[model samples]
Target: IRAHHADLAKLLTSVKGVGPTTASTLLAQLPELGKLNRKQITALVGLAPMNRDSGTLRGQRHIFGGRADVRRVLFVAALVGTRFNPVLKAFYARLLAAGEPKKVALVACMHKLLVILNAIARSKSPWSNEIATVV
Candidate 1:
């Protein structure tokens, strides 16, 4: 989208989990979100932790899966958000209080950020940090 639409790129990074890397990655993976729900969104961003278990191990869900490239970028954007974005800061703190692991909480945050990005794309709006609070 950003190739032809410089504005979307400018708008995207202003969102929580959308840095240059994630903004680009999302454009590639979720080429058509006109049909994705939150679940599909999660899978695309590679934030969906899988549940794998055997007999003795139980494998307590973790996030060693999903698209590594996308995950890499989203994770970085998520870290930035936790420190800088107000809504995400609160959301991260809430998830931590709920006893989720730090990594998991961050992933949850990424999921939310991705959803917002999708909405922006669908709605044909651009983002600006100055106006982030209004959203």
Candidate 2:
């Protein structure tokens, strides 16, 4: 039974506020890979960047608004992610200095976390740091 959601399950194990139930909800709500491109899938899950492309409108990366239930769990996980995930901690601090709301900064960190998960699932590797990538 469509157990690819198990990939999400595995990733969530190390994240906070992401027990089986929360991970299950995320999988249920996110787009199936066949239904959308990777970018689109991230957007559908409310994890992609948003742009306000127009004359002097000021483009910004807005958060996923696709599913409230899914987003709620993500918020909690995102909070914890900032504290524990090395990459997310740096991102969160940078975003905060840029004057983004605390919650918004947390959400941006969440997006980075999701992107990392996407790669981890594709590569079948455990989480590693940007430091590792660079060194």
* TM-score per model over all chains: 0.73, 0.68
CA error at residue 57 for candidate 1, angstroms: 9.8
Per-residue lDDT of model 1, residues 6-121, tens digit only: 56665676675466777777666556543576677677656666777887877766656566776677778889989988878988999999999998898887776766676676
RMSD of 2: 3.9
Off by over 4 Å in 2: 1-8, 15-18, 31-38, 49-61, 130-135
TM-score of 2: 0.68
On lDDT, the leading prediction is: 1
lDDT of 1 at 56: 81
Candidate 1 segments exceeding 4 Å error: 1-3, 33-35, 53-59, 127-135
Q: After superposition, how far is residue 56 of candidate 2 from its true place, in Å?
A: 6.8
Per residue, candidate 2 scores C-alpha lDDT tens digits across 36-134 of 445765687777777877997887756647667766777777787778766677778989999988977887766665555555545554456752233
